[model samples]
Target: MRKHFFGSAERLHLVLMLALTFSTGVVDAMGYLGLDRVFTGNMTGNVVLLGMAMAGGTSLPILRPALALAFFMLGAALAGRLLRRNGEGWSPQTSAALLAVSLGLWALTVFVLLAPVQADPTLGSTVTSALALLMGTQAATAKRLKVAEITTVVVTSTITGLASDSRLAGGKGTFWQRRALAIALIMLGALAGAAALHVHLALALALAAVIATAVTVTGHVAHRRAEAEAKTGAESPSLARD
Candidate 1:
């Protein structure tokens, strides 16, 4: 029997990535709304906010967004360096990276719960930076998974693809299902995050952390199962020849 509705491991990776896409929306919402107008996951939004801050004439923060961008790049660089030797698709490195993201998010969640960002500027900045770093790590790990157009962090390209590749655009509308799902999931995640913030920032971070943990565990199990099945298939072929 197939292990999932999308039977292949490759398709499973796409679904896993879509989950992370949702988590990214949650993280971004927490950052933008709770953490002083910063974006932890959506670097494109962060960049634009940074540009506007630099342009002057507003009380918009410059330092926090700038720090978030820096830490995010650092996280991506570190994750990429760690994953450089691995080939496409999930690996031990992918699991480790995701686990690290999970841990980081949980740690931030606890910290926020203990020291509410509204009470301390330093803590707020620290949480914001940490979230950015974790998000960057997640983005890199998802990229390594190579689930095609599902990048998990930003949906701009997915939107563009959905529109540009539509039947109205004189092209065969392929992969629209995943693309549309990615877009919708991110939006829903953002809504969830915002709603959670009405209660507490920690709740939002905790939700993201939980999703990260789930993704890490599920992906690792699926990868191991796929590897074992391949091994069994190879052995069966040799045994048949004998």
Candidate 2:
């Protein structure tokens, strides 16, 4: 079936995206709980929270969400520019972009280490801005890559698709694995990150950085294997997935 593929490259890409999705949950928990009640991955939540704060329903600060929206827009714009220049499937340029986001998270980890001691120690606007910008870039890049259900950052539409397309609801059953995996990874990351944060604030971001870097390394390996196969007059399995 078209919905399923046997190519190793596409399967690797999907697995990498799931790792990044887990990182998204970790970073988002960091942002929402640690960084002034802002959401780094899910801009929809930021928008709604901003509106709620405006209407006096929630106590979240409006500035952080506003900054998240602005920074995410800028990040997405940058990712769009990069994608236009990339002009191919799963190019190195896209890997570079993903790496950049992870590097930003590592930078945030340093900031956390330097932070002053406090009882609650909710982070500041800078952490929120850094994470939001990268998440926006990540969301855009994932969308361009066209993974079936692995958006990596946001799960709202995935949830909607899951419910709206079920056989019980009289719609074709598709994306069951991708959608289920996406949801599960995010939840797992959130739980893991939340537990880790209680031990050390920077540990969550560090873990996220590790997962994101692993994705990049996996891409590099796949790309190298594809090149080798090409030179050997063999069909590149990785490129086939592309």
Candidate 3:
């Protein structure tokens, strides 16, 4: 059990999960601050916000929220295709590819922000939609991977699990602890990103790109090790005979 818990693969997965959480926080903060309260990283929140907007209680534009939802679904579909093709072997390669695409989009966003020419609302909306789609793709990939206590993009369910499994509720699980840690990390990332955004939005995004790149490298290494081991085992005669 100790070996399983502290294994290199497990550690790599944990690091990648945390990196995804941080990415979500940074992107979500950008969306909220720059895109009129629409959460690009958390589609669940966007769905709720969309419903509220449809009810006419909020000032959010219905079309933008709807576009966000559609784009998110499209991203999820793309991730699903990757998962289906790769199976459990998807590993870091899938994440690396997705992050690479996301990095490109973020670079474009930075260019737009730095450009002397200002964009109209339509252009801004398009940017937000693309960012949201990238985030959604990530969220779906994580979901398909099904890493415990590390969904990374949204924590509402994690928070609920924490509370439901707390000591006061006669539970002995560490759900609350894990959930709290995730929330804390996200808050820290958002705070750091927000501070950076004040002076340099591109800088904050660049930080996210760095984190994603690190995760991608680590994941690929781990997956390669696993594949090597699997191949070695397959070639063992006794194992094959059995």
Candidate whose TM-score is highest: 1
Model 3: how far residue 106 lies from native, Å = 4.4
lDDT, candidate 3, 1-242, per-residue tens: 11232375655566677777987788777667755677777878778887887788658667666777888888878878767766553465476656655576557557656753224677667766877677777777777666778787888888777887888778876755567878877888788767776865566667777777776666666677677777787689777698
Local distance difference test, candidate 1: 0.91
Which sections of candidate 3 miss by over 4 Å?
Answer: 1-6, 89-97, 116-119, 233-242
lDDT of 3 at 39: 73
> Which portions of model 1 show Cα errors greater than 4 Å?
1-5, 240-242
TM-score of each: 0.95, 0.88, 0.84
Superposing every Cα of model 3 onto the true structure, what RMSD results?
3.4
Error of 1 at 5 (Å): 5.2
Better of 2 and 3 by lDDT: 2
Cα lDDT tens digits for candidate 2, 195-236: 877987688889988887787777766776676666765556
